[model samples]
Target chain A: MARAAVKAQAAEPLDGAERILQILSESARLFATTGYDGTSMRDIAEACGISKSLLYHHFKDKDEIYARITLGSTRELYQFVFDRLPEGARPIERIRGFMVATGEYFQRYRWAWVASTTAFWNDPEQRRQKERMMWRDRYENLLRGLIQAAIEAGELRPLDVPLAGRLILSSLNWMHRWYKPEKGMSAPQIADAYFDMILNGLKVEG
Target chain B: MARAAVKAQAAEPLDGAERILQILSESARLFATTGYDGTSMRDIAEACGISKSLLYHHFKDKDEIYARITLGSTRELYQFVFDRLPEGARPIERIRGFMVATGEYFQRYRWAWVASTTAFWNDPEQRRQKERMMWRDRYENLLRGLIQAAIEAGELRPLDVPLAGRLILSSLNWMHRWYKPEKGMSAPQIADAYFDMILNGLKVEG
Candidate 1:
């Protein structure tokens, strides 16, 4: 075959790392739609066009795959948002940046975000659960810390930091239930709308 | 046996309706913790201290039990909120009442609320899913209607009603992830806090 024709073939072989990523991506889609418990190794293998035995070679079982996807995606989300936030920005701006960055990341990886958030937590993998909880705490704490700084800086009124954090996170997290990229507003635009609503309040000025 | 003594026995015979409610309640608890696919008819029967055959007699299978719990609880939730809201109240107050009533209902029936919200939607029962979606639309429309009234009445600024509605509902819906009655604030109190936050905004007045 000519070099161009060979390169253009539909069955170009994926390297080990690329193949693993493809598996994880496809698995996330299945998990998002069918749920963690509803999905199986055979189903994931089929989705990835890999043999079940090959999938098993990379991960022991569905639980392991779920754990890997959830942990990795959550960590990536945290890092993605963290990197986008301006270091020297005002507290309010940083909070806005955080929300916007998160929404962007969520939109880019919709399936992964849904799979991570909706992953079955009550499964028997206690150690994995603990790790997941740690990441969860870190994620919550990041937002809470920003709220605390804003409160102390007098940009915001004194309020329950955790409650405020949850409020902001709630709006972002629940986007999976209704948001569609093709519908109208992009994720960051929706986030900005939420931020404006939150910052300005809904009540008419006296 | 004496009537009082017999009544004091733990295994007093429950009427049919009461027995069904008990089964639903127990099944809700299981479904909340173990998820829909993870839970089984046998597990529910074991939880309720009833025979599997008896459980099956009441419902055809786990899906029926789930559909019954979800539909019934969601309807109850809607009615509960509707009845508690004041007819003559301003849109803002009506909104507050809705949130508080929902929180109270959620706290009182935490297991059922969790089970209903987390019920597996991808299951084969299209009819139940349709019913569930109808209730969901009614629930969303109730909030959206109030928001539209608020905007028209000049109590609130012109905003995207659906977006505003989702922002409020998100805070309320996400409560199941963390709220606990014994920890600190009651559900209504937390709802009030959220309402205050959303109404007053976070930024300090100039």
Candidate 2:
């Protein structure tokens, strides 16, 4: 009988990986809307219309699901931008491309970005700590490299690369908090506005 | 007998104002850390070592408490900065004072600011909507006035004042998402950094 039960469980159409993804997505939305500590495992199961036992089978707990979702987001973001950085593109074009891609990502995956950022401070567990560090390092390195190249090529002003990188990223990242799709401006339009502001300033050139 | 009961209830050392403030402060912390829907009356009361009945006495319900806290924050912010804007001050100095005061508010009431912003999107109930609209109007008006004054004074190059105002507020608001008191930077330092970036670009002058 035990063997039969095991076989039935294994043969179920709901595989662990699929179940995990569903849980992560639901949890991400809830966390983004409600917050990490605010969401419960029961919330995820109900949102998914699955049994608690079935949900547990896919993942150990909530933190595990949160970590997975955040890691996936960070990975996807890094790959999306870094993979397309053409070797021979001018610094101006490169920076613009990066900003555009970032704006698009913010528009597309607004919830995930919100969840990751909101949870960063609240969860100081060791696992979360490591994840935050890893995510920050990846972005810092990529941005530093881009800014350094721009400065070397005389395509950009010589500024403190690290601070400049933080400012640029912070400006772009802030969009998720306020950008509404219902608004008339598309992501590309917003990106263009930001690009113009960063390249120049509010002052119209003489 | 009813009068006596009423008198007894009123006589309990529970200062309505003080009790309400305590509840608001606790709720802000929980909401900032957990999220609005994640916090409950029981949780809040427990955190304050009071019964849920006492909580309800001061607040009609959770939404009321949330609205009160948010509205209170906006009132405090407006009071802090508006009072400091001197009539004869240069446009740049006025802007700086605004930024510095805003940074101080965030530092002192970090949880309240975070809760207000995060809850604005997550909860769109009537009360939240009212609070959000009030905040939006205040911010828009303040920015519009600042930009006009700056332009009139020739401190800022002419551009879209409304848009510029939104962008400036957006950048400043994003600070709560990442600002940490323990991160080796005070509120003043962060405000200074932002002010410098806005006044001057990262590029060294040719």
Candidate 3:
């Protein structure tokens, strides 16, 4: 209790944006570990080293915080990948760009990325739900568009565009299930490996 | 309440094995939709149309039900895939066999598959956890071993075996996120499409 009080005192002086970021980071870590239903506002407050009132002042409830973290982080992901792909670049390069950027972002915000996947979006928060789906759709469509372009450019063979998009997304999105930052291969290396396999069939060239 | 009683009356007439299967099916669906924490034993009982006492008679608690659902279903999956794969099958055929069997099992037991992925294994149920992890490892090793054999047979180029295994799993496992039975493509069709992409590069061959 004393330690929590000390921590709360220390947190009180941070600027609003930094405090919010800290709250989000800590809450995401908690949510990723304990799950959405298992986590409560009190838990987030304690985890953030802030008092309940202070936590509530920034966000009304757990759902709002979850929505913020999921939607905000997703928007950042879309922008990060979008900005990395250069104009007039080949479709294949854009695909590469998307994979690399996603790996970097995922590694940097591993907690939030994991939490975003697990977040329960079932409530009647229609506005946030619609916005969240928009971001998700945008992120997915970006890859699908790149695949479509690649097919048209004769870089990729004509295929089912949606399934191809799903294949790429699956390889990247499922990383949260097993990819650990401190363990085996780093995210970019794995992404590169996947890119290699996707670009070149596993079969011998002969 | 009358409907629930009538449902319970109907459930009572089943044999022990059939009653257990009904309990597992209802529990898996509830656990899939509402999540583990969000679901209660009472909810399971109501969903199964069984009395709380009767539900407790079969499974001690929610954890046991979850363990039974995840581990038992996984065991069945391993056996199903193993049975489909012949002993002297070539490495590529084993890979195809694994993928197709997985799609079929996933379609047949979609709720259990989804529940297994989301089931929290954090508690100190060490024995069940160990058994669960063992089944999971066995399942993953089967795929990895197939990839190793493919490389050895000169059927495929040498690559990171574990990453290759994960690529196949990622594509198939992520289906639970979006693929719907009532929707666009069947699971086997999607698996076949993924197989084609993995076997042949997305690029237009020169």
Candidate 4:
């Protein structure tokens, strides 16, 4: 009995992690549909074909699962942006690449991207603060580098890099809220529109 | 007893609407911080110094309240956008005025704007579809007019009016997700940046 109990205990965590992933995936779908406060652990568990106890065995609580989902998204976003920075590329080319990469990332992980940015506004205490800091540092660093490069290359007009960064990031980040995959406008199409708008001013040139 | 009961019942709805508004305001604050699914009607009632029964007397349910909040926002937005169409103004002046008005609306109703847009993505079956239809109609009409006027007046290049409208609206609509009043960037300032980028194109003329 003791040996069987030890083996069972060891197997539980592995089972728990798998269950947790299932719960989170279902929860994300529900949360995306119902809003976060509208969903519950029971809902997640029911969707996963498991009990609440099994759900808790893996996640500890709702916020943990939420954090995991967002962290996974952020990790993937960071990798997508950082991994594709070509060595010694021109500033304009680099910005274009970043825009394309951003569009592609959202195409694949659109729901995750939506939840992290919008849902972060709803988190509390330490989790909210930590997530905000992480996002700020990550985005600010990437933007600052691009802006500095653009200015040095005389590709961009003189502007406060951080402020310009925030403006550009805010405009891009807002895409997930309104972009629909079925809306005839593909990810690349939307990115191209944005690129043209940003690169060329709206007024007709003589 | 019957007369007193009738009086009480009639008065109840008036009281209920007021109470519901209070509950919604508190719920918005909480939901804006903790997320919609993360909050409960019990939590909202508790925060409002009311009982669950009293809360229920005001709202049929949480979804009812959510729907009301979004509808209210939509009504306000529609009024803001359409109430000031200047038939005699220059195209540039009209566009600039619209941008300014939009920026001010965002600054004043930031929470409601965020909540409603967030709900658009998170609640598709019940609320989002209707909201999207409303949004698309409003946007298409407004942009179609603006683009037509600009083209006739020899201002803007001949572009797909609906597409131009979506592009412009997308930039403005995305502002609520990241525009913090405390961030030293006023709504007008951000609007100016966006307006400049859109109106002037980013390329340096020889």
Candidate 5:
């Protein structure tokens, strides 16, 4: 079998990480479509076109699947935003780049966003909820720190640091509700418009 | 037993609309605590300390109860914001008043805010979903019109009108996720800070 695998790489279409991501991505859609309680491991197994045993091998239970989705999505999202911004970019530019990458990813991973919106704070499994919130706080604090640096450097105006962080992120996060790729406002355009509001302030430059 | 024939004045505690509101508000909390799918009419009945028949008598089903919660909450929220503002107030004052009212209500009715965050777009009951979105659009348009008026009157900078509206409301709506009454920041204080950022511009006088 090892020799045959080496001879025909296409036989195992997806590598291990890719296979796991595919399972997670597919399960996220299901969890989004049906409430978390409404989705079962058998459902995920069927959706992934794998046997139930294989599904368990990948995920011990739905709670683990959900925890992975939440953590994975959060980590990937933070990495995508930070990595996409070129090092040494101005703080304001860094913000715009982060928003653009985030908007693009939100558009692409609509299901994951929806899945995260589910109420995990009150989850019966306390560990999963705590794990999710830990990552969330990390994301919030890092973003808030970037904004604070801009304020300190005089690149941005001083305001309530925590509120500013929430404001910027809320605007971007709400995109999943209304953004339509077919509607023709590209993600980059949205990033520009949002930055316009955030950096320029809504009151016409006095 | 049909009201005890004009018995004690305090015998029947709540009036018709008030009674319904009480039920909806309680159910909203349960829905927030437990996923919508996890909630049952029997559970709502139990939560309200009423018989299942009485609960059904008021709401034909959970869909009806949910629809009422969404619509009632939206209508009350809109009225709260608009009614709180005095006629002919300056755009800045009007905006601040509106924010304060909204923030107060979001904190007060935390459960309804959580309920609205749930993914109703793909709800199995399409009618309930559409009914909710219609009110949502009405709220959005009303808010957008107020912002446009501000821009036209030179109170606000000319930015993307719709985007500005979304940004402001999104920031307010997200309060449920993070705001806690015991967090030392009052709802009105949060509102003032938000209005400060939105109206005064975040950038130091450029």
Candidate 6:
């Protein structure tokens, strides 16, 4: 009760953006562990230490909270990876950037990522078509485009670009399911194993 | 209506094993498409052309249906791969066998795999612990062990065996998400791409 009062007091003077951020962070934590379907708006309100009406004043419902968080997080993730790239980074380095960025991002925002796993899109064909491109597809295409560029430059061998992109992303994505901090492999170190295998190739030279 | 009637008649004379197989197969198909939470006993009965009492007579509930199908299927999948392993086959071929077997199995029994995604265990600590090992961890351990064997025999490079297993299995596990039989990549063909990439690695030789 005391902590709730303090949190409410701390949030009271903050602007709408800060209040929303606080709400989203708390909502993300809930969604990651309990799942989206398992959570309720009332639960979010309680976690926020705000009234249901106050939570609604910020966002209409749980869906809105989920959409805002996922879209915002994905946009930020893409930016984080792109922002770190050296102006003339080699193809290998660029690929490394992607794998490392993805692994670290999943590690940092696991709950949000897990929450995003639930199916949320339900709309007409055309709208769903456009929604498909918004985040997940765009992320995949970004990886595919990098692989294509590398192959064109002869920095990487010719392989099926789309398949290769999916393969690398698959490995990285599954890390969220099994990665443990206690296992002694940092996100970068885990990423390094994948990066090294991809760059070095697995075959022994004759 | 006629087809359901025919299926019901077909099962009338079957032994318990065949009757159970029929129920599990139909249930797996339903669970794959409609999802476990979405599927109901009545729906399974309608699909199987059996009464609710008859369905209950065979299995207690949805959870029983799920466990039977998943365990039976996983056991079969393991057997399928192991049966195909030739004496003195190279380490790479053995790995290929796992990938192809997994891809084809997912292609064939995708609904069962999807159904197994939901939680079924409800026991206190120890049962849940065993449940975890019974399915996912056991599978991961199997792959990791194969990778470790390859590494020990110097048939493969020394690297993180656990990471490699997850990476390979991830690509295979993810097939149900995007695999389309009509899209030109057969299960074996898709597995080939993964088998090739993982075995040869993706980087071009200098």
Which of the CAPRI classes, incorrect, acceptable, medium or high, describes model 3? medium
lDDT measured at residue A173 in model 6 versus the true structure, 0 to 100: 69
- What is the C-alpha lDDT profile of model 1 across A1-206, one tens digit per residue? 22222223315677775566556666788876687678989988876667899889999988777777766676767777888988999999999999999998777666667776773434466776777778778888999899899989999998888889999999999998788766689899999999999987888875
Per-model DockQ:
0.56, 0.20, 0.56, 0.32, 0.45, 0.44
B44-103 per-residue lDDT for model 1 (tens digits): 877766789988999998877877886777776777788888899999999999899988
lDDT of 5 by residue, A32-121 (tens): 668678999888877666679987887899888877787677766666566777579887777777778777667655566656765532
lDDT of 5: 0.71
Best by DockQ: 1
Q: On residues A1-206, what C-alpha lDDT tens digit does candidate 2 reach at each position?
A: 32233234434565654455446656777886687789999988876667788888777998777777767667656766776666688886787777787776666555566666664435556775677668767966887888888889887777767666766777777776567777567665777676666666554343
Q: Is candidate 4 or candidate 5 better by TM-score?
A: 5
Indicate the TM-score of model 5: 0.74
Candidate 1's C-alpha runs over 4 A off are A1-26, A30-67, A120-123, B1-27, B30-66, B120-123
lDDT of 3 by residue, B46-88 (tens): 8767789999999999988877886666776787677887578
CAPRI-style class, candidate 1: medium
Interface RMSD of 5: 2.1
Pairs that clash in candidate 2: none
lDDT of 2 by residue, B78-114 (tens): 7666876666888877777777778776776566677
- How are the candidates ranked when ordered by lDDT, highest leading? 1, 3, 5, 6, 2, 4
Q: Which regions of candidate 6 fall more than 4 Å away from where they truly are?
A: A1-25, A32-64, A119-133, B1-25, B32-64, B118-129
What is candidate 6's lDDT per residue for A24-126, written digit by digit as tens? 7668878766877999999888876788998989899888887767665565567656676555888777888888888776665555555454343222356
Which has the better DockQ: candidate 5, or candidate 6?
5
For B1-206, candidate 5 gives per-residue lDDT tens digits of: 11122123224675765456556766787776686899998877765556788778788998888777866777766766677775798776777777788887676555666666655323566676676777677777877877888888898877678888878887787777677676567777887787777666666676
Q: What is the TM-score of chain A alone in each candidate?
A: 0.73, 0.70, 0.73, 0.67, 0.73, 0.68
10 residues in a row with least lDDT, candidate 4 chain A: A1-10
